[model samples]
Target: MKRSEQNVVARSSLPWNHSCGSKSFAATMSTKAEIPHFVDFFKESHWSKKKDDWLDHKCMEKHGELENLRTMCSQPDAIPMSQEEMSVAVLGKKSGYLRGYGVGRKPCNTNTTSRDNGEEVIILREELSSLKELNDTQQQQLEAQNEQLAIQQQQIKAQNQKLEKFQEVLLRCGLLSSDECGEESTEGG
Candidate 1:
């Protein structure tokens, strides 16, 4: 009947079905709400107190068997790209939001795409070169070790020859018995 009453009927999405018994009841059940914006984004959101609530059904059941992941999705980098072109470069083939699209599989909108550039390849090249250099150094060290081993073997061979000659001389001079040299002692006593 009034402007406020008319406004209430016009604004309300649903029709007023229930008949108010009292004037106070009708006053309390008006179309107007304290919240100026009727559309509440987080009005129906529920907060999870437990960590296992976020996981998949199977994972939730077998929490102990599998790794308890903090998040299944990959986290984005911290780099900021303010410009549209930078956003385009960062986003790459996944610019549906900026370009305008109704429905599409959204690319992982993480800043980790910066690594896909040539700069990362250059970094990888440097790492590979350094590893190769280290390998060469290790190879050289191994060769040096082999040379030292060969020298020691030659010295041992020379000493062994000298000892053999000394043993022969001792046997000839009757200083060491043949039995004492290698064979068992001949004298039973």
Candidate 2:
């Protein structure tokens, strides 16, 4: 293994001080442009008190892969983002803290592998087409619900008409008075 890799491995094995005075590895390294290895951060003081769980073991096994991804993302050819975008990505937009305030203003690097412009456009078009199809399906479902609502309204109107007819018939047969049928007698004395 390379000297730096060996150093990182050695650091990962070291016991971390979890006292109040101790700053987290993430807090210390946040300002630096280089992304630290996952093992370096997670293996340190944070969860040292707990048993080495399955998740920790799994993450440790894949730390190298995570480091590789970080390296790829931080490459010079990666896409540039606005300060606001970087802040949102790092702190999350919903967080109450102002942009680039809580953490040191280290911007996240975006991974942008080379792709043909035409191919990229085609991929975006395909995604847009899929979204349109989803919107159309939702619209169709809404229209169906509206149609059902209209049909229900018509059915209720018909039922009300039948009930009115029944009430009129009962009134004529003397089984129901105008008061009993919830109607005022219109005839004047």
Candidate 3:
């Protein structure tokens, strides 16, 4: 069989092979400017933008084959893109492609601002909890300090009462002479 006929047959039979088969064909057709219809068909297919890295690799490999075919056919100007250009284009387009059909979900209106707001809420909750804990600790310390102050005040009151009784005894025993007591009273006054 001719090489071209063999390639066509192989491509046709690929539907029964595996999921990677369609991707491989798409990649193979990507380099051929002469086969724009096939290229468009592959690009528009739902399976083209799947998240399967193995399939992507196989597709890339088949694209290399298309380049080889172009080289063999001596149609240098028919090349779709230079290696550098293709790489840049592929990288640039991949994000959009994945976001569109590759992710298999409807694109929502979520943005970076919403994500930042979520993080801010979490931070604020943590800060509030910490402040509450600090306030509780301060209240406990204040209670402890107030208890200590009460104990000290009771000690001072007892000491004052003892001093007053000792002074009365001294005066009653006459240990302080009248003149001395008189002087003491004057000093006390």
Q: How close is candidate 1 to the true structure, as a TM-score?
A: 0.42
Please, what is the TM-score per model? 0.42, 0.38, 0.37
Best by TM-score: 1
lDDT of 3 at 101: 21
Task: Please name the candidate that would achieve the greatest lDDT relative to the true structure.
Answer: 2
Whole-model Cα lDDT per candidate?
A: 0.44, 0.55, 0.53
Q: What is the alpha-carbon lDDT for the whole of candidate 2?
A: 0.55
Candidate 3 local lDDT, 35-129, one digit each (tens)? 45322332334234566333445445544554554455456556454332343343234433321122321234244446757987999999999
Where does candidate 3 stray beyond 4 Å?
Answer: 1-110, 176-189
What residue pairs are clashing in model 3?
none
**Decreasing lDDT order of the candidates:** 2, 3, 1
Better of 1 and 2 by TM-score: 1
As for TM-score, the candidate ahead, 1 or 3, is: 1
Query: Worst ten-residue run, lDDT, model 3?
Result: 97-106
Question: Which residue pairs show collisions in model 1?
Answer: none
